[model samples]
Target: MNGAPSTVWFDRKRIAPNVPEDLESIDPMCEEIGKVIQLEVDQGIPRNKIIVGGFSMGGCLALHVAYRFQQEIAGVFALSSFLNDNSKVYKDLASSDCRRPPLFQCHGKVDPLVLYEWGESTKDLLIKAGVMCQFHSYPRLYHEMNKDELDKLQAWIDQTLTSS
Candidate 1:
């Protein structure tokens, strides 16, 4: 979300494999996220003490922000999200010197909106890029969050924050 709540973090007519991404809008949102990181740093929060995350489209955006713009963060947790190869994040993540933070990604096995395979592939790509990733799948879940996911996310966040 920008300064408002949203289903996806940015505007997209729809999701398709071949359509060129809307970087015209996406860049500004990423910059906004960067600003938040800077604001937190200015408040004396160490880069490693800050984490970025979200759900669905939000989850995808969080990954972009953490892996691409704010790599020094403590960690990232994405629930049912994926990224395409065209985005700047994909390019940035491919860099050899990129810092890969710990990631906790959870997906629903039967999610119809954001397919489970997409989430798995994203996690796998991050792992192959040398990101420390912890992935979880919920049986028969759709495109929504549940108590169990929240609990596990909380535990992961606590462990990450404490360890860092």
Candidate 2:
């Protein structure tokens, strides 16, 4: 500890051992999300009302599941994250029955772990595939969320939930 604030961390090595090559290792997480979604549906929640999102690795998984999920959901929120498997996402987007939920992806310009270019690439890719994605970049920000991001996220959640 270098006297910095403690933060939540995901074990990327264990989650995606091959990094840029083998993103399939995270597929199990998407399966778990499916189970949770099933449970939510069984409990009387409509699938379209469910919004999936997270930060960092969790955000990556959220994108993966939302893109590949058979049912259309409310939206996807990914913060300080990038697509785990660009090829897989492209393939999924090519499907005729693919879900095209609105996506809100926010990243920091100064993010050291996940470069800004990666996040931009993700937004561009999704847009090219005809997905509605709102991308926000914070100047001088790091690999974390700030008040502005939170405020925007809150507004997005409110609007999406009410409109849908």
Predicted candidate 1 versus true structure: per-residue lDDT over 21-85, tens digit per residue: 67777777889999999999999999999989998878878887887778889999899887764
Relative to the true structure, candidate 1 has a C-alpha RMSD (angstroms) of: 3.5
> For model 2, what is the error of residue 73's alpha carbon versus the real structure, in angstroms, after optimal superposition?
1.1
Alpha-carbon RMSD of each model: 3.5, 4.6
Cα distance off (Å), candidate 1, residue 73:
0.9
What does candidate 2's lDDT look like per residue over 70-126, in tens digits? 347899999988774435766778775666888999999999888878788878888
* TM-score for each model: 0.89, 0.84
Candidate 2 — which pairs collide?
none
In candidate 2, residue 147 scores what lDDT? 94
Candidate of highest TM-score: 1
C-alpha displacement of 60 in model 1, angstroms? Answer: 0.8
